[model samples]
Target: MATIDLTGTDFEQTVNDNEIVLVDFWAEWCGPCKQFAPTYSAVSEKHEDIVFAKVDTEDQQQLAAAASIRSIPTIMAFKDGHLVFNEAGALPPQALESLIEQLKELDVEKALRESGQSE
Candidate 1:
């Protein structure tokens, strides 16, 4: 699937609707963010089941603040509407693929229980 541009308006709904969503919080002026765009898009094409969404922080300041984004090229992965992975930095294509593999093998409910997030 091609990456979708997300705004504050539809962000939450999109997450709720998708089983697995990868959100890339980025800005246009950031060199690393620009460099990461193609890599992100390329990976998105390989995963038709995943939602690859991008938020242009410059245009979505409130959303960025809500997500607590402190740096450009921050990537977040959500599974079953719960955040599973979050990190700041541009990942190489191989690393991103590896992360997807781990996420595929991950048990979200068990992870939440182990982390004491499940009540």
Candidate 2:
């Protein structure tokens, strides 16, 4: 699947509607963001069940702010409506693939319980 462009208006709804969501917070000017875009899209195509969305930091400043994205290539992954992973920087293709596998194998209920977040 192609990466969807996310804005402040649709961000919450998209996250809530998908079982697994991977969001890339990026800007066109950033070298790392440019480098990571293809890897992100490639990973997205491999995982059709997951929603891969990108938010342009320059254009979607408000959405980036809401997500507290301080870096140009911040990657956020949500599983079962809970934020399971967030990191700043670009992940190589292999590492990104590993992350997707990890997210898919995660037991969301157990994770939420361990984090003290009730369902």
Candidate 3:
């Protein structure tokens, strides 16, 4: 699972179409983003079940605004077409692995019900 580039046009489809998606919001000029890219890519390679994607904030300003992303290298996880995790800062490889494990444990159906997205 390589990291896919997400643009304004394909943003919704990319997230909604996948059962579990992890998006990294980053910009080319950010040092932290540059440092985090390799870790993100490595994580993607390790996890085949999760769809990993990245959005270039400079090019996708509208998408970034819609996502309420104010910082560089924000990571968001979506499950069942709903946002499950949104956080800023760079995560170590081990931390990212732990996050994936946590996401796997999440009952998305139950979460959707609790969030009033389902009956």
Q: Best candidate per lDDT, number?
A: 1
RMSD after CA superposition, every candidate? 0.9, 0.9, 1.3
lDDT of 3 by residue, 9-97 (tens): 99899889988999999999999999999999988998899999999999999999999998989999998788889999999999999
TM-score, prediction 3: 0.93
Per-residue lDDT, model 2, residue 24, is: 96
Itemize residue pairs with steric clashes in candidate 2.
Answer: none
Model 1 residue 22 CA deviation in Å:
0.4
What is the model-wide C-alpha lDDT for candidate 2? Answer: 0.93
lDDT of 1 by residue, 1-119 (tens): 99999999999999889889999999989999999999999999999999999999999999999999999899999988888899999999999999998888889899889988885
lDDT tens readout by residue for model 2, 41-116: 9888988999999999999998888899888799999987789899999999999999999998999999778878
